[model samples]
Target: MTKTLTIRRPDDWHLHLRDGDMLRAVLPHTSRDFARAIIMPNLVPPVVTGDDARAYRDRIMAALPADHDFTPLMTLYLTENTDPDDVAAAHADGLIAAVKLYPAGATTNSASGVTDFTRVAPVLERMAQIGLPLCTHGEVTDPEIDIFDREAVFIDRVLDPMRRNHPGLRVVMEHITTSNAVDYVKAHDTGLAATITTHHLVINRNHILAGGIRPHYYCLPVAKRETHRLALRAAATSGDPRFFLGTDSAPHTDANKLLPCGCAGCFTAPNTLPILAEVFEQENALDRLEGFTSLNGPAFYGLPANDATLTLVRETPEIPAQIDTPEGPVTVFDPGMPLNWTV
Candidate 1:
């Protein structure tokens, strides 16, 4: 039985709209569903300063369809040499909504990210003083840290210290994928918030390796064990205002993705909401879905819930197995078969 559903429109708190060709290719897929998104800043040069962020925002705006009401909330890319005064100036001028800290070598296109937290202390201190949120790609790039435990270690080693150093600073643990991340965010819910990805809520590391190597299912802070997946579902639909939708709908070209060392990301925007609905149904937490999707994120960011409304019906929607883009055809992440819900 398909029932019509209505909820306050949701925003994607974390998104990767890669530049140039890829930007044009995937903009519509996201804009069609989300009212606004906290755009990632990891381009080749990266949006490190206010000027760079403003210019990048303009390019994203020009790329969107004229009818699209999507607002691309910009974030400054933090580097080891980032200037303290500049971060304060940008926040004061309203040039950026948040500052993203991608530890050097953490993920895709993060080669220019900060190498040591201590080196960027001045910048971090300034952001805290002016009330800017430090959104993080929570992971350790150290060769010794087990990939699966990176997020937890990051919380213990990096985030915990930074939070202690700047007690009033707002921080968002973006695209949280593990049970440990949920526990950490909940433990610090008074001062921390996390954005849960649709893929994490529905799949585990096993799904990525199921039957055969599935490139489309791989992503950074890679999916974890079955227990983590269940915990993510519980946190996502638990009606907690600290857990919200981030999608993290990162995209990569087919050539790069199918290579020997396939790039890490999942181009799931096309099926993101559908996948979330399926997960909610499995947990029988559909009744609490709206609050997680629409209410939690805005509360975390101190923004108002979207005034518009969106509907996600439970009818089976046959999305394509792959969608052709300018870069090349990209495989979509599907959970075994056609999802029994659509948005």
Candidate 2:
């Protein structure tokens, strides 16, 4: 057996560290394993402006542990009324790494997202001109569309046309869950990429719907059929630069997740590295693990890979069933299988 493996420290291309007590409680889990992360901007009010992103970044820094060596690469949430010039300036000053696009009502805290895509054409054009990447939620909120089909439909109705209109715009299809998404990304040689999450690789729709309703297994861009899970695993382990790791480790308190209409997310931050190592080892592609979790993301974002290294030993890890927070207990994602790697 391959006993131990070391690679450059990974970066999360997509992450959600909710503000306040939740932020303080969860920030350490990610910083412990990752050297940096692209912090999601979908707070209740949303980080809409340069000032908002700056303030949010400051708060993230304040919440980070003093001894942890980690950086929060911030992003701004896109709204129809967003100021293109402000976004450009934020990138110029290195205040933000990217801009997030959430179609209104697509996911949690997304009410402030863009409802009218046309209204943001100017912003997209400006982003393309400056080579700023647009990280997208990749779902359409149309009530008529089947929930399982939202991602594929969004590509046809929203993403494709947007890309067609702004040829130079760089886009990251964050937390993609469908093979259609994989094909779309493959068709485009450049200016397009996709982020696959840890939970998605291990679970499918059955994990959430079978036997009983497993709330902890539920998440936005909900897991699809088994075939799609296989596709994601293939893409992530393929050593393809166009696909990379983005845990999308959204945390919701157990109270919030068990309600009649529970929130959608999987709190995978605590054990992502171990779970990823297990997945990569199973695929017999341990060689590509570094590219997925560490190198590809930085290259896609035009940043340098981390100099620090993380070593994973082949041993089972003790993962908590739940983590405590001020509001309530938040369940850590259970990969539902034994993980034999620990960092």
Best by TM-score: 2
Q: For model 2, what is the error of residue 309's alpha carbon versus the real structure, in angstroms, after optimal superposition? A: 0.3
Q: Please give, for residues 149-220, the per-residue lDDT of candidate 1 as tens digits.
A: 999899899999889998888999998988888998888747689999988877799988978998888899
* TM-score of each predicted structure versus truth: 0.96, 0.99
Report the lDDT of model 2 for residue 203: 99
lDDT of 1: 0.86
Lowest lDDT 10-residue stretch of candidate 2: 314-323
TM-score of 1: 0.96
- Candidate 2 Cα RMSD (Å): 0.6
Report lDDT per candidate. 0.86, 0.96
